[model samples]
Target: MAVQPSRPLRLFADYLRLERVNLTERWMKAVFNDADLSESDRLTHEQLSDHVPEILGEIFSALEDQDLDEVEPSIERNARQHGRLRWKQGYRIDELVRELDLLRQVLMGAIDSFAQGHPTFTRRHEERARHFVDEAISFVTLTSIREVVTERDRKIDEYTGQLERANHELLLKQKLVGELYESRMQITRSVVHDLRNFLNVFAMALQMIARAPARTNAALALANRQAADMKTLVDELVEYSIVLGDNNPLATEAFDLRVLFDELVASCGPAIEAKGLRLVHRFDPQLRTITTNRLKLKQVALNLLTNAAKYTKVGEVELDMRAHGDAHWRLRVSDTGVGICAEDQQRVFREFERANQDDVPGAGLGLAIVSELCRKLHGELRFASHEGEGTTFEITFPLRLDPGG
Candidate 1:
């Protein structure tokens, strides 16, 4: 992948400030010259460009299309000069904006802490301030350096000369290891492709519903629900990918735990009742509000419930919710059904793994999704079962927002 050059900076005044552009160019050139480079280095060229003409061209194109006076000045001007992109490939444009805002917030926080006499800042105000700024700048530069250079030739040489010799003496399944990672990447690509198609279908469904005559109210309502459900499924897939595919977590909110569980149960109530299965909702009396990604939590709940309904011909599926303290919550989904065997529990959370070779139409992604969600939330997700008796999945999450939550 080739790096796209950045759009140039447009000086607002008659005389442009070349110092900022010159420094930024130097920084970028240094990064590009670094030996340790990654795929991100290639992406920085396209986004956050520094070529004034290309940026101006796009801006003028927009102007020619329709709106002129209302055109965004940032797009047409020196926006690229403000440290264009932190990490081009691994992150999104929106995420970059959010991080920039967060960086500003951290700086504001330091100032606030200094003013409020916060213990560390109060004792060593100047020292802490200097340390934070220095560290932040160093981090920015380090990341920038890694994202602007692709010294593939040198990297291979170094690896071959230093690491290959050491590894050569050891016996290892090199082919298997290489193929396994390739397989995982392929899985990610396929899922992402399917998700995009599904989203487009859902969008088309919404459009159809909107265009339909109002007299077809019943049909429209059903279409709307189906569209919403499909959208939710796509969202679930996206969240699952973020948690597993990208090792990222969903953005969490401090939501009402009781309500969250209630809606989940309510959503699956129809499916449970349709299968002649008894569903129970058990809650802790002392339970309080908790912060979590409601959708992923709901996904885990429903995945368990679906399994419960599918396995047991006769029995109740209990969803038990309890709280430990202001910082922890417990959710147990127990079903009196064909339970997981001891030997299979270890591999159950693995993607595409199943307990037995039964003719089930599942891709074995449910438990995998659950495990990833728990991990992203910095918690525990596990399963316990007695074959032919029952199975229970326990997920413990911090009531507080997790590191990645």
Candidate 2:
């Protein structure tokens, strides 16, 4: 009723058992010698060799039983462990792939050597052995990659949970602070909803790939892209949360003003170009250095620039910085696009309040954050907008943040 493994297969299994150490040594030598696997140089012998011996034993079991299914679970377990270990050791996926490829080559070479030494090992036996080793190596490669992906998914889920809990706690704190909490709570809800949508898309893509692994490359790429977008949103949410709280104090330092705007322009250049919009910036050549919170100022400028780039479908976004009298400096961001109507002008700085929420892609917190930062910096935030024309936002901050200094 059942077919037993041939004598050659049985003897091959015994050869694997007796030569496991030799096989492992050869693999290690190969890995250490590989230029792409240089990361292995940092690892101790035991760390690099972890779970590999068990994988060889499982390979031996597969050859002995003539059924890969009988030993696959154990193989998977060892392979997963090896994968996680490699990941923690800072191994890139390609490097892990290269490492495993080396192992496959080494094993195939060993199989050929074994065949050459034994007269009983016929051509048919050699082909079968090569097939078995190839199957095991292929399975190992897939399982290792899957385990890494699963780990990444777990981390993203954990981070999203943490952000949700932090937002909840922030809402409670804002509630006790004042009645303004209602508006903030609404903003928080909108942000969470948007984040959940991205996460859902990412999760669905991952599930589809899991179900049909053969068609995973494209789906995996989509998943990674969605994950990246989610991270960007999460970072923005964190910044908004910190701005909402009163605990974060301003850390001011005197830095070159020209250097700051130059960096900001460079950062926003790609996004502006994507929309086919021109970015025009004019900095007063006289303004060499300013004593202020460089990080907060950078954040404020970035938010304003990105907001302009997002809303303006055509024409140019202009950023201007000039001296306002002798006491202060004026920073203006103006965009040629659909402007805020007179009716919606009053609530422009309110949290989660967007005039064209449906037509635009934003959480409606850009101006709100800008308003809060201006208040913290003790500066004035003013804007001029026409219904069908364009909008200009300007902030006038004292030249010296500490008036006494």
Candidate 3:
């Protein structure tokens, strides 16, 4: 027996077809204009609009057919492809879902708008159309999400395996260098402690995603930020481990002091701005070039500047470069933040020690790493702090580092 499509649905599908071009334009505008999809700003119109028109066409066809069975395969294939393309475009899972959700909203809005204009679109007709449209959009959403999840899982597994192997080798080497074992253990305990604190916040954000659907975007953003912070912690830990394990001589090179500080200032701009703080820097006119391990120098300077920005709430962070003497120069980082108390001042250089860990967002390794690198570069690190005033960290280094130094 031949089954006939519903006349009302057929007419509604025709209306959708007529408005498909307009709907696609609306979807593109909605996505690009959305603040949550800032990543799309980097993409061109053609790249962002890929496969969207086709997806709309599938929806319209399914509407006309009065059954999704005829269009489900096409929808799945197109959606999977769209998901892969978005993945390659650096779209996060939340962002991928977000864009499509916007599309669904656009389609729903169009359906309501159409129903309002047509006297024939009765309450029953609107209900049937809404249910069908929702089903079609759900199919696309689930298929695309599955594709993205599969790829992400595969990449995570591969990276996890590589890290495991690297960890095993590192453990063997650490065992041979028995002196480094205690330092590494301190770092591990500190990392675990900080990670537990971060994970608690992350889990709470995930839990809120379902309980408060209105805040799903906010929750997802929190999760992404937490993940990024964790990555930074792991990277810093690896760099610290390398610094600890290294016994080789320092690598010396000549680099411009002004250029180095300029880069540091630029890198610190975003963080400083986010907290509504100012970054002020000055370089001695006579200090043109210095012969030293520029990389280590920059690392130490950056760690200090980053720490300054992190702790300062209402005032400016300053970086001052001055010629200490004919043979030495000093780098100073001053911040108007909650200064270290007299009691906690002695432990500032110790590994995994923080005066206010509960309120701060560091793994407590910045100054320790700064102290270690200062010794390696033959630089002397000194600081002055007052409980309510602020803190100043100054490192004095020789203008030229000899191989033995």
Best by TM-score: 3
Candidate 2 shows a clash count of 0
lDDT of 1 by residue, 1-405 (tens): 112211211111111122334333444454455444333366464353344333333333332232332334443233333333343244444444443334334334434544454333343434433343344333443333443333334556898887877676443667667756875875677567545655675666667667775635665565566556456555655655666665454677877788877887888778877868788889897787677777767777777777677676667888899986667888888888878888887777765565564434344566777776667667777678999898988888788866643
> What ranking emerges by lDDT with the best candidate at the front?
3, 2, 1
| Candidate lDDT values, in order | 0.57, 0.84, 0.85
Model 2, position 6, has a per-residue lDDT of 91
User: lDDT for model 1, on a 0 to 1 scale?
Assistant: 0.57
- TM-score of each model, paired residue for residue: 0.43, 0.50, 0.53
Error of 3 at 357 (Å): 4.5
Native-to-model Cα distance after best TM-score fit, residue 335 in candidate 3, in Å: 0.8
lDDT of 1 at 282: 90
Clashing pairs in 2: none
